[model samples]
Target chain A: MSNKSLIVTLLATTLLSGPAFAEDVTLTIESWRNDDLTLWQDKIIPAFEASHPGIKVKFTPSAPAEYNAVLNSKLDAGSAGDLITCRPFDASLALYDAGHLADVSGLENMSNFSDVAKSAWQTDDGSATFCVPMASVIHGFIYNKEAFEEVGVEVPQTETEFFAALDKFKEDGSYIPLAMGTNDQWEAATMGYNNIGPNYWKGEEGRLALIKGEQKLTDDQWVAPYRTLAKWSDYLGDGYEAQTYPDSQNLFTLGRAAIYPAGSWEITGFNAQADFEMGAFKPPVQNEGDTCYISDHTDIAIGLNAKSENADAAKTFLNWVGSEEFATIYANALPGFFSLSSFDVAMEDPLAQEFVSWRGECESTIRSTYQILSRGTPNLENETWGASVAAIKGTKSAEDLGKELQDGLASWYEPQQ
Target chain B: MKSPRIKSHVIVFLAPAVLVYTAIMIFPLFNTLRLALYTEADQVRMFVGLENFRTLFGDPRWSESFWNALANNFWFFVIHMLVQNPIGIALAAILSHPRLRFAAFYRSAIFVPTILSFVIVGFAWKLILSPIWGIAPDLLSAVGLKSLFAPWLGKEEYALTTLALISVWQFVGIPMMLIYAALLSIPEEVLEAGEVDGITGMAAFWKIKLPLILPSIGIISILTFVGNFNAFDLIYTAQGALAGPDFSTDILGTFMYRTFFGFQLQLGDPHMGSAIATAMFGIILVGVCIYLFGIQTRLKRYQF
Candidate 1:
């Protein structure tokens, strides 16, 4: 056969295969997780397509940084996909207010989620929900087990012991004491401040009080975390000032750093890269007998596009997402992202299991600067990022950082004023 | 007016360029300036004449960020002027020597960075300077100067200066090429006149070559001003949108972008962003006007 005829025959076969048994509905999902493209195509779509033979699903993602802008343009042009992956809090809430996202309240299995899980994507008064909660990441310390053993240190349960362990590792000089860096800014705020903060502030109590204007940032509970972070700088090692997020991750995984102040999302990546046995411990309590608290921050969710043509099929997929089966597959696939559904997912990764196990022992609350506190000018979340970095670098005193944050918050936030 | 047939022919010939420019450039510029005059209240865009500007200048929250960015931008331009252009002129002078060898090779090597993408240059420099994976410390240690190596990009005091130097390294080639062309264009007759006057070598270049290239220097300075004001990609790639270690490297372009499109948790406020953009346009306009009317008119563009 001639080469041209062979090409024509291949094209004809491809064309003929389509519409042979056309699916009734094809739903396209828009997400910022371009990393999960294969996970969606190979694991998620296939699982959904199996049970629902008449429906097909497609997963399309943009670069994480560009997703919001790309989605906004697509939505404005009425060209967006059927399903939209939601960011936690105000970003997604703005989309819902603009009528871009359909309310997914009373969705199938929505009852499985707690109010805290749903709060991130809900209305201010908690009367309406826009997105089905997907996952929450826990904050803690992921440590190198070999380094701990080699340095003759046990997992630190109190702030005093935590520092002692760090000193031991620092003294040995075989490894850097801590792997986290302040260059990226978010790690200082998220993994360092929020992780250890809940214990000081007593979790939801401090967070709620701050929202109600009952507690200012200058309050000892709020300011104390900054004081703790100042000491973190000492163990961050030489030339750590310029270290980025990926560089910190490499330092920890390469067994060059003893402890990494981390979010649960680091589990899968750390497991894949590290040859050393890894273990996680909850954020150290101030005292040995203190009640512990964890920042189990709700990070992501899924929502239906208000303009989706096939709402029924889209809902079917969304409903499936809120199911135990989907939750198990997702949670196990991405170890750190614990499903928000209350169906009791058993995380297969040991480090992930260690992180999730904290929920039973510690009081859980989301990051303090999230929710309504971050909605105004001098956004508390962004402000916290700077304040935390300053705190860790010892550039600003804890009391001064607190005052600066409080002043910024009071300028616009009504309750704070 | 011309004859109807001639005018129609003229219109037909000019239509595409006119329409394309209006659609892309003129319209957007006007629209952005118009947007600066409005504020979004309850999702309604209402005309509030000069209110946004007042807020930008008088409101400490906005003004602090604005002034910081503006100051950083000036420093960035100064670095380019003080370091990049002078070095460029020196290089062009050296390379322009009558007996210089491998001149073309040297020229191409320096110009290579100018053609490279900003993202690649930013990331490459980031890795090269990185303490952990980088060989910078090793290289310094090889010379017994390891203690001198600090994380230049991470320190707030040094970040903007470090970034400015990186930008200079990338763009010094442009000024070099421009000044080199200007030097090459000076007629051989002028050099003969200089030789006759006993003004050969350094004296010949300083007295003869330097004066002829003054206009080129003026043009390069203005181009540097405009380019520096509009720079966003390098800082955005290296320092990120926040332009940290506490926004030390934040320039007008990054400031406008952050306000216009938002960062992590901050939502976009187009009106405020437009106001920043309009301010930038005004600054550039004043700079260009100063170059054109005040400076350019005074520059002695001598005839051959």
Candidate 2:
């Protein structure tokens, strides 16, 4: 080959490689629901790329349960993504404490959100901020409105009426009163134990007592929820343990279950069904004196991994999530209750608007239970609460369950110092 | 003396496999074992001797779960022993039938599930058995056994069994193929000779074929035992580490995972997790030793 031809080819190759140097940043953002939220990646991310010009955002998703596992492994290896999604509660406090999370303390638009949301988003007792709440979710019983109407039951306002309505549905043979999936243990704990039990336990006080080790999980006060759950189990379809979240959801949507106790995250999935017009309501207390409690967790949040190679780009992305542009897209496409401070996205879905209005009353009395119960309580669910489910099923007695939970949690709570 | 070239030749021939094995297997194995002898406080690891083991076996919090999972793991192993190997053996024997049509198709069809990722299988099974969907009920009703249709996966009484059956369904083909290879290795002259001696059909299978294939069956059983004891993928994919419906399906592998990586309530403790891993390794080692020395020794093979 001639030297001139070779020099020309090399020059062309170097010019092509120059753009690669300019577009040097690849920010990996990992979440559990990239497939579920395909719109965000296809539309919103491209919009960001068009505006930003030189940065590329690679969306990495892991399987639901394995997401956290993979994330933790990455963190341990010091190779975590630039942006990560986490549900910020008591469980996530350890990640914050370990210095694995970047503090997005002074990010713009932090002042606009509610104090409760900001507090919820913070990791180090509100001093350090780790994540920005991408979406807020509320947990309540989502009833099939048509199913309830067929059974001549109104939304139960009190605990007595709730149980009566459930019984009435059971008597009519129209549908199972409550369709619960236990394939995920946390489902039971979320709907059965954390939601209703806390209401019966006198709300936040009861949770605090458990957290402080002042109240034993075996105490007689705890028996009511177990008995209530045992009764609730009678209405669950046979082979319910094998049933997963989506399966149980199909029960409610298909008109097999009158009441499906789940979170508002299920609303979109429910709305897609042709068989039912879904409605959301809080579970009624067994007694009039009992305050209604709603169980909840942040559906998703954006946090910067402390080990990110590109912290500036990660910060910019997080800032956009909290910005009005991102929130508008999220609210319009996703239809979740956006927790941001200043967004003029009109309340589009009538059903979702009703939930938003009701959420005001719900959050007023809303208290966190699982956080206190879960924090520092090792094997408490598996050995105690899980055994309780089996015990209530007549595999073991209630007394045996009480003893098992009491003994298991004693070591967990006993002074380690 | 042997030539100096002989020593160099041996090293050259064996070097690649030995180096690869040492890097991948021996190093990680020892590292995991070494990690078991440490404790973590505020993210810093400290040497803790056997305290982690003591905590695993002695502390009420860890001991009960550890023991329960160990028991469940044994039951899981038992199910494989009772179901997988026998079905595999039967299918292998039948497929080894030279008269059978489309043997390759049957073999391939049955073996398809073994290639599926446990995540896919777990979700697929979860959807198929969901009572709300009514597919399971429809199938059962068609079989004239609709009354037997119940939520099998959700009930604590039946969760483990259902999961075991699902696992066995997926894995039976492995043993089937292994034993099929072994059965084909047996010469046609022995079977023809058996037929000539008036030992034919079921009798020939029982008297002559079964004895020769005993070693293959033994190997399959040992493999099943080891696989079942180490089983985690399906349960983890389906139920998470907590193995819910109140931990009814908690097995040793899941328990080990929960210990290693903290879930909603528990903090991750690598020391305890490593100890559990060590315990699992020991159990598997003991089982392998027993199979090697005991079952393998008793199963005599006469070359045909």
Candidate 3:
């Protein structure tokens, strides 16, 4: 055929297929993950388009820190993406209350999600489901098996042994005992300090005390953890404060630090490195009396925009994300500990298996620091904690630090209480 | 007395821009301020008058945060004023020098960071400063100053100041270009006359060039004031919403975000957020006013 005739024929075919061929509607999925995950979107969306025959998915990524800022800005400006990853906190609740997120209860496959995940997505006002759960990222301390082995230390299971192992590692001078980079303030809690703090200082009883307001943040018990953190700080290489979040992780990966107190989401990135024998442990407890706690941070849990024009498409997407096929897809692409109750998909990473085991064995739940510290305390309390960490380390009395926290909490809790 | 056709044309010409500005900027800004006066209860909003503002400034929990961020925000602005604008002026003066080579390349290189998305700048800097991953230590080691490399972004004492300097580094090009353009616009004869009268080099810059660019400098200062107060993305991206190493880098923007969006446990209060926004707006307005009434009028425009 002549070039003109062939071009005309192709145009006619495209016209005949119309929106139905390309998945007529283009929907944007907003997430805070790195743009490197565009591969997932580019591949998955095409498959969905081909199978469903009418939906083109566009991925709109935001910086993880600025995710909320961007989401708020977009929602405020009334130009938010159709689908967005939502968190289980007041921030998400606020967005829901603002009438920015659409009610997604009527999605056909809502029943596939676990009860906890479902409740997490529900608005605080007992309103309709406004979001869908994606990957359930849980946080804990992960260590390099090779580094631990090289240093002749076994992964400490109990809290007492955890510190002992670190001490041993320190004595041997083979590895930096703990690979924690506290430069990122949130890691002090999320990956290490906060997750392990409640387990060690408060335990389940302490956690209960905190919830009931029987204990302020500066209780005498908090001293132990603060001291422990200070001890850990000594093992950190000189000029550790210069490290960023990714830097700290890289240290662990590069075997500069023996252990990284971080979340399970990091396993994929860590495992990708060659010759790393990595195992994750819930922040170790000092005694069996204490709870072996692992803080949960479900990564990229998705929800519908309350004002989404493509509510039906969003519903379909949410249900698909919760489906077994979706589970398999996620497992194949980005394998980690997800919060799906469906027994269909298996975990790929061994660290995830360890996380799953600890999660399964958990007897009680203490809300993570991100939840408590964020929810109970007003903003910038963490900032105060960062300064206070140094203060306490600098021969400042634990009592004084505790009192400061007590005073601080009193200021925050008094008004809200 | 205006003709109907002229009036219609004027309205038509301005309608789109005005509508968009109001809808996107002015209306939301006012709405945010209004939201500050209301509190959320069981997902429903309650009108609380000045309660939110009161909580923000008076309640210990809110007040501590507000004051810290406020103080930090002021410091952030002061740094920009002291470092960014002056440096920009200096660079602009140098770059605008007669027969300077590679001026375009230097200008472009300096402005590159400003055009980059906040994520790139935040992470890139974070990487550069990372003792574990960054080459800063390696580069420093080459110069025998590796001991100087510390995670500036992670330390409570250094985080804010470090980030401020980073911001100044990225944004200096803006004021530089602005002052440069303004400097170029000054009449050459005036400069020549100044030269003839014995004012030259540093004297010419300080006595002659500096006075002429006062209005532009004033504009840059106010812009800095407003921008610094409203700043979020850089700190948020580099520091996270928690603004940690224990919130050392917490500024008004991050504080406002945590309050408005509820990070973990604390419920987000829109009223409080709105109150914060209103406070920011008030602060910015006061700053602009001070510049307009107190400073700008005294800084003679030097039309010549």
Q: Which docking band does candidate 2 fall into?
A: medium
lDDT of 2 by residue, A146-218 (tens): 8888889988878778888888888998798888856665667666665566566665566567667777666
**Given candidate 1, what's the lDDT at residue B263?**
77
Relative to the true structure, candidate 3 reaches a TM of: 0.78
lDDT of 1 at A319: 92
lDDT of 2 by residue, B147-231 (tens): 9987777676788888999999999999999999998998889989989999999999999889888888888888888898899
lDDT of 3 by residue, A294-409 (tens): 55554446788877888777777777776776676665566564655454567666777777677666633434343344445533345344634554244455556666666655
* lDDT tens readout by residue for model 1, B39-83: 887657899989999999999999999999999999999999999
Ranking by DockQ: 1, 2, 3
- Best-matching candidate per lDDT: 1
- What does candidate 3's lDDT look like per residue over B66-97, in tens digits? 88899999999999999999899999999999
Residue runs of model 1 more than 4 Å from their true location after superposition: A1-24, B1-10
| DockQ for every prediction shown | 0.72, 0.53, 0.37
**Chain B TM-score in candidate 3, rounded to 2 decimals?**
0.95
Which of the two, 2 or 3, has more lDDT? 2
